[model samples]
Target: MNKNLYIFKNKKRYRVNVRNYNQEDFEDLIDLQRKAFPPPFPPDLLWNHEQLTSHITRFSDGALCIEVDGQIAGSITSLRTNYANESHTWEQITSDGYITNHEDDGEVLYIVDICIDPDYRGLGLGKELMRAKYETVVYLGVKKLAGGSRMPGYKKVRDKLTIEAYYEKVVKGELDDPVVTFLMKSGRMPERLMKNYLEDEDSADCAVLMIWKNPFIT
Candidate 1:
């Protein structure tokens, strides 16, 4: 709620701006995606301005773009779904006779994507991007926030305890990530969801599905 409109850091300080996407915004959006990911998504997905607009238009509250010095530096997309009665949010888990959760007006906000240019790493851009999505979801009266995050490797071992440790001790439900430290700090992620895996040639990459219940506006 600073409303001062920018986060001032050292030399590489970055400010995040949230705005609805226009058809003209596709190229820069795709460029931002390429700069953010290791294996960037296909550019053909947003081949034209119209294609970008169509993607943005699918969100319940529309997509948001983050700009640093008048250029697109990052972006986030959120989806609102009627999961009021559905026990499981994952499409892979839902089954027949599963009383389809009816929002009856209630809805859950799913953060589909959050990305930041590599050049902007260590500047807290990813955290800001997440905060933006959280604020937006709160404004929309969503009751739960959820997402799936990819781990670097399936069986990768770390000298560190785990991402969950950090989540439990530091963040304390204020934030969450698939990395065990952050996710555990934010909230406990269900093992049932965490164990869900995909096959890879060398090793399978583990993904953790996380959920944070909104204490406010519920």
Candidate 2:
């Protein structure tokens, strides 16, 4: 795979390249994930080097890393799954975080995880990564992209509103939940609300099912 498949420029004019993950990137990617999603979740929920290696070994192009100034700044891991009309929880799609659920002939590109280093936030790298994923969809000839959006802001209002209510507010622009807001702006439509999606405190044990149809696919 070409290491320079995708490239972007941050506001500060730094070059950021999205490329296939290499074995050397394991530790750095682990560190980035730690910083991007700190505690509150069990250690088992967090991916380790071995698990990531398994993913890359199974499907090489399914994982990507972002390089900025010669360092790994962010990474996104995805898998291909058969197109299903119904919604899927994170555990169901990813097989309880094992990530062995990937299928090469699947019809949909499932975005398992995308993380940007905290220091790299606000530089539009996340959006650039999303674009890279769309390119992956086209490369894999998938019909669409699907994933569960973590509601990082849900815990704040979990007491006052139900998960469905909060999802409606976020979709209607009545709330500013970061993850959901980004997905909406990126053209991903909400499909349903997933209960106990993951072990994240920020999401309040819920996630919003999101889908982005590929215009180029048919």
Candidate 3:
């Protein structure tokens, strides 16, 4: 696929690209977290030097960034792992976002997170990032793409519904959640519901384990 992409929105064309993260992108990545996820999304959970270092050093192929007008506008970090009918927390699976658990023999690609600069949201950059992820799955010959998606929308109805019920409603298209809706529309299927998966209060500290199988794989 072409590394550079062009899009026209609101009558203005914008240059965009998705590529592997480089050493120079560190600062931009740090600031992006603040721009993408603000207050109530714990600042302490944001990426730091050490964690990013592990992403690039250990699983460089999965450490990707998207550029808008040559500035780092978004990123998706992931790792490799082998798994089955088992349960694990976000920290346990991703090594607290450092990807320290990357396994060379791992057949599954697990996404840690994807964040986009608020300024670049409407440009469909997040979809571009997912496009790259699917491509990566095919390229790596992995069984599928796996990730735990946080449900920020559940918080508003926590007093009215259980997380599982909320998740079910979303899956059945009875509700529209910013995050979960995006994932489902992107072709990811819900695998399971997890508790205390992350620290986001919006999700009530819950997450949905999701997957997209690689059709290219046997």
**Who wins the lDDT comparison?**
3
Residue pairs that clash (backbone atoms under 3 angstroms), model 3: none
lDDT of 1 by residue, 1-218 (tens): 22225667775455566666666677887777766654333343222454355445544353677677677777766556564233342333321112132232546666555677777665555666666666766777778766654444323333443544432333354333334444444343433233233322112323455666666865
Residue 180 in model 3: shift from native, Å? 0.9
Q: Where's the lowest-lDDT run of ten residues in candidate 3?
A: 83-92
Per-model TM-score, in order, reads 0.65, 0.91, 0.96
TM-score, structure 3 vs. true: 0.96
Greater-TM-score candidate between 2 and 3: 3
lDDT, model 2: 0.81
Model 1 whole-model lDDT (C-alpha atoms): 0.51
Q: Indicate the residue-level lDDT of 47 in model 2.
A: 73
lDDT of 3: 0.89
> Judged by lDDT relative to the true structure, which candidate is superior, 1 or 3?
3
Poorest stretch of ten by lDDT in candidate 1: 94-103
Ranking by TM-score: 3, 2, 1
**Per-residue alpha-carbon lDDT of model 2 for 97-193, expressed as tens digits?**
5678778898988888999899977777787788888888887778998888899888899889988899999988999898999988877898888
For model 3 the local lDDT of residue 196 reads: 85
Separate clash counts for every candidate: 13, 0, 0
